[model samples]
Target: MVDVGTTLEMVQASQAGMSALGAGLAVGLTGIGAGIAEMAIGSAAVGATAENRDVFGLVLLLTVIPETIVIFGLVVALLLLF
Candidate 1:
């Protein structure tokens, strides 16, 4: 027969595993999304900057904006883990 304590420990372990998986997915998926977003913006920014050097600063800002999604994802992962 299985011991009750052992069963409880197993359940806790499974829960911990699931939490970790969730955290990993949160960070990984967001990073992927941010990367995709950056790809499009980066290409457009490059084109715009090439056409008008004066817009380089704005282009740079636009390029960096997608990175905020990664930060948000990190926060969510931390929350999930903790």
Candidate 2:
């Protein structure tokens, strides 16, 4: 096997690859968390709607709260890629 520290370029390339992998993992984990959060939010919205239609506006806002996390992850990943 080639030595990982054989050259400066090799070291830099390895670091870049690791950084990309980390970014991917971060995004995946964040997305999963967001999905789980949304599941509860959706159920609550449905329940709220069943009892009172007036809750729709509030539910809409609350339900989308988890999405902001995913958006943040996307922003960070994009910054890393560029």
Best by lDDT: 1
- Tens-digit lDDT track for model 1 on 1-82? 4456677778878888888998899889999999999999999999998999999999999999988988998898899888
Against the hidden reference, what TM-scores do the models get?
0.83, 0.79
Clashes of each: 0, 0
Best by TM-score: 1
| Candidate 1 TM-score, C-alpha based | 0.83
Give stretches of model 1 more than 4 Å off. Answer: 1-6
Candidate 2 local lDDT, 1-82, one digit each (tens): 3585488888778778877987897689899999999999999899999999999999999998999999888888777767
lDDT of model 2 at position 33: 94
Candidate 1 lDDT at 67 equals 88
Clashing pairs in 1: none
- What C-alpha lDDT, on a 0 to 100 scale, does residue 51 get in candidate 2? 97
